[model samples]
Target: MHSLGFEPNEITYGSVLSACTAFQVPIFGKQVYSLAMKNGFFSNGYVRAGMIDLFSKNCSFEDALRVFHDVFCENVVCWNAIISGAVKNGENRVALDLFHEMCCGSFLPNSYTFSSILGACAALEELDVGKGVQGWVIKCGAGDVFVETAIVDLYAKCGLMGEAVEEFLQMPIRNVVSWTTVISGFVQTDDSTCALKFFKDMRELGVEINNYTVTSVVTACAKLAMIEEAIQVHSWILKAGFYSDAAVGAALINMYSKIGEFDLSMLVFKDVGSLKNPVVWVAMISASAQNQNPGEALEIFRKMLQESLRLDKFCISSLLSVIGCLNLGRQIHCYTLKTGLVSDVSVGSALLTTYSKSGSLEESHKVFEQILERDNVSWASMIAGFAEHGCADQAIKLFGEMLLEEIVPDQMTLTATLTACSALRSLQKGKEIHGYALRIGVGKDVVVGGALVTMYSKCGTLELAKSVFDMLPQKDQVARSSLISGYAQNGYIEKALMLFFDMLMADLAIDSFTVSSVLGAIALLNRSDIGTQMHALIAKMGLDSDISVGSSLVTMYSKCGSIEECRKAFDQIEKPDLIGWTAMIVSYAQHGKGTEALRLYDLMRKEGIKPDSVTFVGVLSACSHNGLVEEAYIHLNSMAKDHGIEPGYRHYACMIDLLGRSGRLKEAESFINDIPIKPDALVWGTLLAACKVHGDIELGKLAAKKVMELEPCDAGAYVSFSNICADVGQWEEVLKIRSLMKGTGVKKEPGWSFV
Candidate 1:
């Protein structure tokens, strides 16, 4: 019309500006504004309202406000436009202020004004303000379907589902938006049963369901893990031809995976027309990884790369979960850097976890530092990586830094930090974190509660640990097991046993750690009767084959002096790991079955199980017990050469005991002198015991002197020195030693036996 030389009027400008606003063409809207201004049509209310709508909808709220204030007169249309725009731009409080200002002025709020204000209320979760808005809606009689639906949404989003449902039932007329709002609300609140029920009611009423409704229903099914309801929803989706929608297909895939039907998820993936939708691809990848099909997940990602589909943050994060090696993880990390997706918090967090799990904590920390904006997940991932890699101090330091930056810790962050505190045995830091959890109102969350229990138990604060356990709303296996393990570790064997029996009485599922802890308590008690009953229970529960359980059984039987039962438990293990083999060898050594222990050590080496420092301790002890001098010498030499294990104090003590037992006192004394590290009192004390056996008076005096110098308060050294003197018929030396003990104020402790 302008090209035809027809002069544009206020109506003409207003219609064009409205079109621009509807299409979100801000540049064109600006050109129209200039044209309207030049034509002197700015004074017209129609053109003025159109310009405000155009600027506000396009998120130029300042320009919209300038246009509204420039006009001498304002209407409800301008007020509604600016308020709705503020809410859309996430300036919820500003929107509320604008609404109050408009209400104080001459303009009466229409249904559009009330709808926008209710939206601001929902965004802010301002239930009280929303109730006031509902009252205004009734007073003005402006409760149209749009306003009523907004009211429903306000109550729903605020988690007042009862009010939401009541409002919905009172609405004389309802649209698809109202039904979808209530269904999606229930799903968001974790009331999946109510969500599904609402969907069924909507279907029975013959309301046309949209893609959003179907997606919500599928999400509800996934949460409930109800495969039958999910299948029915899938059929309905197919009949409605909504299967072609990407979001619905993704939801169905996740639902099937949650129900443990990965094959059905695969079938749905093949049927989905959303091959180009990154959402569907991400869901399939996550489902495959979650269902233990990482290989398949990786293959699907390869196909996605082949298809040249754009990868979003969810796609990158899901792919990261399936990565099993550092090389593959680095490849993905390089890709993310090139695509500028590394700046995304989710992708950065995923990379951190992948590197951490693949034993590349350095790379994980580097990734964490490169994150442009660190969220709670990024901080938590780095902290957990430090804890997992045994950098407890670094983990604790990073947690403190996160707190200094005012990053509110989530459940995962608190739990990971607590784990680091436990590893460091920093009881003070653990208590501070517990206080933080309580302040944040997540103290009763089961995951955080269990972590608190573990942290306290590890720090040897059993009273605090039990308090946290008792405060937990639900006693999960982790909390119960941690408390039992703490009791056993602190010598409260009867308490541990009682808790184990209570767990059995309650029929709560017990994992291997719990059983192992109970076995440790039984071992401390030296009660073969209880151990036998535990063995029978283990067989019934099919936990006998578990390596940890088997190892604990071996140790328990050995402590009870039942070597045969220990061997039987060891034999039951199909493939013993390092801990299992070490347990059996140590048990045999303790029982004086040194020949059998040596045979098992040989068999373990042939089976390619490497011996650690502790393993050598057991091997050396067996040799000492059997008086195998030549074998002990060979094993001691091989410890550094073949296994790269520097012999510790225990290994040296075993050597001293062996040589002294064979009457080779000179060799034993020379060996102690030749130790690379300064020997502890235990090493010299071992030599003194040997001297008493061989009647080597002068060497016994030298060993006892070294022992006393190293440990001045050790009564055992004095007693051993006196015993050695008495054995050699040195009555004068014995009397002198007794007089010296009295002068030093040292008294011998009374000995007791476990039996």
Candidate 2:
């Protein structure tokens, strides 16, 4: 107004003062006040009222009082202005004091004065003061419709919803605005159902809802996910001609997206394109991602970037889901880097996600390092990368680093970390993580809960797994599957079966993992009947085609001693992996069907299935059971040379047992001595047992001494030494071995059937 050359009028100053309050710019308000005073408008009640409104709107009550006192004669409107400003700006005590001062100066209070004082009481949450204002209202004869509306709003906000309703009932002339206030109050209080009923009643009385009414109603629909009701409200908004109003448009986008009506939301957005603000765009983009159309969201986001609209947290998060569309995601990541958006916490977190999805953990780490500010989400993404890349130790180390930085981990971090724990079988560290999770309230968290159960089960902590499962506040099919897998892993076949049956009876949707867990349990039990039932379910669910489930079923049937069923399941798998072959071979070896195990091992090689260390163990075991010492030796050396798998301890143990059982003690001894790695106690014990069988006293005694040095209290070693001495008629030596055993108090445990 001043730029137009004429002095700023009272109306312009009022507008400017309101602008200053809205923008939270107190300095601009002061500048305006100076200009007004220079124009001799200081004594102007309208100008002074604007200045008082400016000061009081920012909780500058002292300045407001100074403005009020400098005025020659403050009128009722001017007094109401300062009081209303003070109340809304969080100066409740000052508003009440000014009210009492007004009454003492013999200035009769109006309905506005009473309403302002009541609102102050509501802001301060002072029920006593609110009731006091009501008493004053009665005594001052100010109980009009407007005064009644303000008091109702105050009561409703202060949690006295009943009193607010009573105030409404007592009003003589209730307007549409007054009814809208009560409905909006109910919405804010989370009573959306009551708010909807009140809205219906207002419409039944032919009271047309303005923009605010439809906006609040749509927001409530969004919360309840009531698509039908939201559509009706949108239609009402269209009929009321508020379709293009920015607030109403933003609410419609959010409601439609939340209700899974992305198409309708887009239509509304395009219709209100001119009025679509940044919030509206964010809502639309988020809806697209939630509806699984992340590509479309990215396209829209590109347009937003083109228009130079600044992105907020939601905008960046929504775009991150499209990372599966790698080409587009890379472009976005580059754009983020170029624009220096990588420093933005949300954007940087999204960048981490994109790199993780692209299998570029190195790039993700680079981006994460560049983030000026990071949250747990960013830390979690980096940790998950380590887990995915088979770097469990690195994952654990990074988790420790996160703690050192004093950043609190949330549930997502816990879930990712448990994967690394299970891989390493680091039961000790995993338990400590579980303790921290419980301390931080992550125990009942849904995503983290199932993983915790899985980790404990994998680490042989069935009791802990069961405790975690039972303590869950709610359990979905994923949780049930995780618990069942835990039981199966820990050899609790009966418990696993019980949980699977219960899950089925509850009518929960069973995925491939659920079937796989049950099949594994049945396999462990060697129950062909249960395995067949699971196989039938696999066909019923049409999950026989999924590689993971099919492979598990193959393994299960093999372990149940049904070679035919195992072959059938294996053949049904479109692509048989090394796991399927290993399962069949190991099962045959276990049942002493050495010829069949050898034949399948050869077939696995001919079929181009890569053999792992476990496969070698099974193949070598087959040779041992059949007394094919030559064959076992050949495969053992071939394992490392051909397959590049270093002969692990189990492989070497099988080779030693094979040669020793065949009475090739010298050859076994030379093989043990020549192996690339040092032999464990089991290797030496195998030689000792063989020497005893052949009555080779000297060799047996020597092997036993070596074994005892490794494991001094080993009952097998003592027995081998004593047996050898007795076989050679060395009574004194036998007595000496017995004396050593008695001194250590070590008793040999009886052999029992293990599950």
What TM-score does each of the candidates earn? 0.73, 0.54
lDDT of each: 0.90, 0.81
TM-score of the candidate numbered 1? 0.73
Q: Which stretch of 10 consecutive residues in model 2 shows the poorest summed lDDT?
A: 314-323
Q: Write the per-residue lDDT of candidate 2 for residues 488-520, one digit (tens) a residue.
A: 878888989999999888888999888888888
> Candidate 2: TM-score?
0.54
Worst 10 residues of 1 by lDDT: 71-80
Kindly give the number of clashing pairs for every candidate: 0, 0
Residue ranges of candidate 2 with Cα displaced over 4 Å: 1-367, 388-390, 403-408, 421-442, 459-464, 588-611, 619-645, 658-664, 688-698, 717-740, 751-755
